[model samples]
Target: MKTKTALVTGASSGIGRDIAMILSKKGYRIIMVARRENRLLELAEKLPGESRIIAADLSRAEECFELYEKVRGEHIHVLINCAGFGILGEFEQIPLGKELEMLDVNIRAVHILTKLFLADFTAQDSGYILNVASTAGLMPGGPLMASYYASKAYVTNLTIAINQELHSAESRVYVGALCPGPVDTEFNDVANSDFAVSAMSSKKCASIAVRQMFRRKMLIVPGFSNQFFVFAARFLPRRAVIATAEKIQSMKREEQNS
Candidate 1:
């Protein structure tokens, strides 16, 4: 029996780190990628199975491609796209540079990596790709985090469409979106937003995400509250959903200012 390899982006901390740990325990050799080499090294040292660290800032397209090339020799059984961040502000108020960077990391990186790996997976007829999106992707619009939400919407939609394509082709490759809401991570500090609601722990979220990935679930929304909100968004009027999202996001923005 050969050990399977799982490559996780944003593995320095938060959801990515937890997911890597879970996969390691589950007997997969882990390849951890992040901007912080030291953190990845530390995480690699603690994993139960064989692990490697590839420190690359995935926000850059060339870097993403380079990272793919570096690991193309390894048979990656699972690919988890968890490298993304958000900027909490009105679309117009946020710096254009920052917004573009967010898109690069949240959308472009996922697209590039998934495309590269999906080809390999389909060729071999077995693999799993878990793209970490957010509940914000389910909403029509997010006022304060507009660009971030839009980027995630791309991830969620792309993952689902690819999953369907695989099913239609009768292929075994699994592609799914992990849509979690407010996981207790460094995201709040990085995004500069305050949470109005309680957050799920990163460990719990990762546990559910990994289990669902193995089951080949299409849309893995972790918590009960997040699942309910995603379901409710589908029934609500688009305008109403957008307005409600704006209100909730605005409250968080206000708290950040206070």
Candidate 2:
């Protein structure tokens, strides 16, 4: 049996780390990428199969391309973009510079890596690309975390459109989005917006994402409750949906402050 290689961004922690571990257990050699070199090193050492660590901050566009150049020779069978963060506040109150930086890492980084790797994958006619968006992506709006929501929306819609293009071209390559809802990870710490409700475990989220990606699922949303909520939002009035989003995010803030 041949050992496949998977390149996972944001592999230092959370969904990315768990996915790397899962893929390694499946006998795939993992290429872990993140800004935290120490964490990546520790994770690589713990993987059951062979693994490598590349500590590149995807916020820098050059590094995104550099990562690809460094790994282009490797027969990468899977590419997972999970490097992202969110901030919770009214759109006007949030710092513009901070939101711009978030866009660099969240939207630009994913776009760059996905496009570059997708071309390579399509050329070879084999590869899986999974972009980790949030269930926030499916919603019409996010009052408190507007920028973050918009970033994820871009990821989700881009994945859908690209999947359509691949199908039209009759390509075997697969591209999908994993839009999990409220996964318990360092995201809350960074976003400063803890979930008002129970959060799903990151391990479970990663497991489901990997399984569905291989099954060629275009949009993988874990948990039935989350799936139902996303579906129900479509029929609700846009104004009502936006108001509900505000209530939910405000609850998270209230919980954090309490």
Pull out the clashing pairs in model 1. Answer: none
TM-score of each: 0.98, 0.98
- Tens digits of per-residue lDDT for model 1, 160-192: 999999999999999999999989998989999
Task: Name the lDDT value of residue 11 in candidate 2.
Answer: 97
Candidate 2 regions with alpha-carbon error over 4 angstroms: none
How do the residues 104-171 of candidate 2 rate in per-residue lDDT, one tens digit apiece? 99999999999999989988999999999999999998999999999999999999999999999999
Cα-based lDDT for every prediction: 0.93, 0.94
